[model samples]
Target: MTSASLGMAHTSSQAAILDVIRAAGTISRVELTRATGLTGATISTVVRRLINEGLVLEVGRAESTGGKPRMLLQLDPTARFAIGVHLDHAGITYVVSNLGGAIVTRWRQPGAGSDSPAEVVARIVREIGGMIARTGIDRSRVLGLGVVSPGPITAAVGMVLTPPSMESWTEYPLAEALEDGVGVPVLLDNDATASAVGEYWAGGIEPTSAFAALYMGTGIGAGVLVNGTVYRGASSNSGEIGHICVDIDGPPCWCGSRGCVEILAGPAAVVTAARAAGLDVGPAERSVAESFAAVARAALRGEPTAAAILQRSARYLAVAAHTLANIMDLDLVVLTGPSFALAGSLYLPAVEDLLSTAFFARQSHPVRVTISTNASDSAAVGAAALVLQSELAPRQSGARLQAELGPEPVPAQGRTSVVGSLG
Candidate 1:
């Protein structure tokens, strides 16, 4: 074969070997050949290339079945790093992580709001630079930045398409601005999508299982993982659970809906209810954290009023969970986000009870509900996972890429649908 043909063959062999190592997590050259359908000579050639590139490392010796022990090859997680940023109405969280998504360093900044796009990008770039310096990771090893913001987002071009909570951030060229500021590629995804990816990576869920992540924060969002892949709908806004109306005419939501989940059970909703009960709730945003903590403290001390408010929020959340389960036929539900840390205990039991009773698949199998282990930082970590996935396992780009680059911008529209009886 010609030199060019030989090079192409070697590249294919290297890709195959890398695929085996990623799938096995750790495996010997003999095992890699068996897993990848590559010959022993091909595996040896590819493994040397991988080691030379610092992408794979010989960790230890694996036990042999009936032959000499072989050196185990594993992905060099520390060989590269990625930065993940979670942009929320409450705060902005930054995490620098290795290829495996283990956070090496973290930083927090004020959340995105009425600030100009340039201002927000500048702050993010400053924080990222500081984090990179502190971590001492070579700039060349840095993959890119993954920014997770609340929906609706255009994942393809990385734009924030007028999320309800941050009205001033409409039609923001978020990814381009951040990339220009930081001088690196920036991937923007919905916070819920990031949370789901984070859960998949850090939460120890089986990679092939279908799971739904309900992220409760300033607003509610859901992330649907179908067979280990995030399922973004036609407009990259599949999991807009906040606008799922539980009460038809109860209260007005900023999204122009009445008695939507966001209006009924978001942090603002809980604080409003608490104040109406004469609890002296402070500012809508600041008081949310303080008020929820007070309520959690009071409830732990057996205060009925605070406990009742928490229960009410949980009940509403349970309704949404049930609705989501019915629509998606999901078996596992993960509750995550800062709001979960505040009111998880209250939300978990109520959600479990409702799912057990009213889930559409209750007769066939039990729906499992659990809080995300890294509840407060799921989105941030998932943002990191976005970078890892882009580097490791990018999806086939056909219609998805075209849709991402199309001229039609995502409309700032919200919908409310009552799935079933709330009771």
Candidate 2:
């Protein structure tokens, strides 16, 4: 073969080796050679380059199989870091995490409701700077920033087109403005997609399973994962479960639909219902715990009116969940986001009951519905995961901060590690 052709072949082989290492976590050179069907010489050369680039490190020696001990190689999880920001009508959450999705630093601030696009972007830039300073992580090693916001979003242009509850942020250039302020790559995605990715990375689930993430926050959205990859539909807006109409002649929704899931079960609907039932819902500035306590207290105190309002909301949410289960035919569904923290008790059982009884595949399959252990902050974590994924496996459109930050070094063979084993 020509010399140029040989060079191209070698480059492709090295990329394949990196892919294997990223999947395996910690692997010996001999094992890598066997896994990739590459020559020992090629593996050694690639490993040397990876080490020189500070991406791979020789962690320790591997078990001896009646022969010389092999040196184990691992991806330097701390070699780089990424920032995740969750933007909602309720608040703004920022998280600094390593490649493995472990949180190193986090900050939560009041919601950016009335703030203009520029004002909110400036605040976000300031908060991110503070987070980086507090963590003492090198700016060079920080990959980029990922922002998860309420949908529906125009992912192609990085804009929050029209968030149902966040009326002040119509057509906001959130991603572009943040990128300009921070001088780094920024990605904007649906909050549900971010929550789903967070659950996929942090929730110990079967790697091969198809899962659905139903996030109930200011409004409802669903994130679908099939075979370990997020499925963003044609417009990158697939998970608008809130607009799904279940009651044609019922309450009108902000989206001009009658009895949509959001109108029937979102916080606005519940709070409105509660207020109409003669209970004080409390001020808007209190902690989420206080708000949830209000709901729980009203429900547990034998106030039939308050209890009836929550039950109605829960029942509507269950209908949405059942619709999602039938459409996705998923094996697992995870409930997440701040709204679910207190309301889950009222919603979870109703969903489980409905799915067990009326799901399209009820007789042929069983659907598991569970609340996320990381409910309060799943979207923020998923935003971090978005940065990690973009760094490790950039799409054809290329890295968001390609001009500012050079390509992330490929993870070494056997460098991927899960914090805990999956069931």
Candidate 2 regions off by >4 Å?
A: 1-49, 65-71, 155-160, 283-293, 296-307, 362-364, 394-423
Q: Which portions of model 1 miss their true places by more than 4 Å?
A: 1-24, 29-49, 155-165, 283-287, 397-423
Please write out the lDDT profile of model 1 over residues 208-308, one tens digit for every residue: 46789999877789988865567777665778888899889878877677889888888777777788888744565563556666666677677788789
Among the numbered candidates, top lDDT falls to 1
Estimate the lDDT of model 1.
0.72
lDDT of candidate model 2 versus the reference: 0.71
Backbone N/Cα/C clashes per model: 0, 6
lDDT of 2 by residue, 187-261 (tens): 667789888877876637654567888898777888887655667765566777888898899888777779898
TM-score of candidate 1 versus the correct structure, residues matched by position: 0.84
Please give the distance, in angstroms, between residue 123's alpha carbon in candidate 1 and its true position after superposition. 1.2
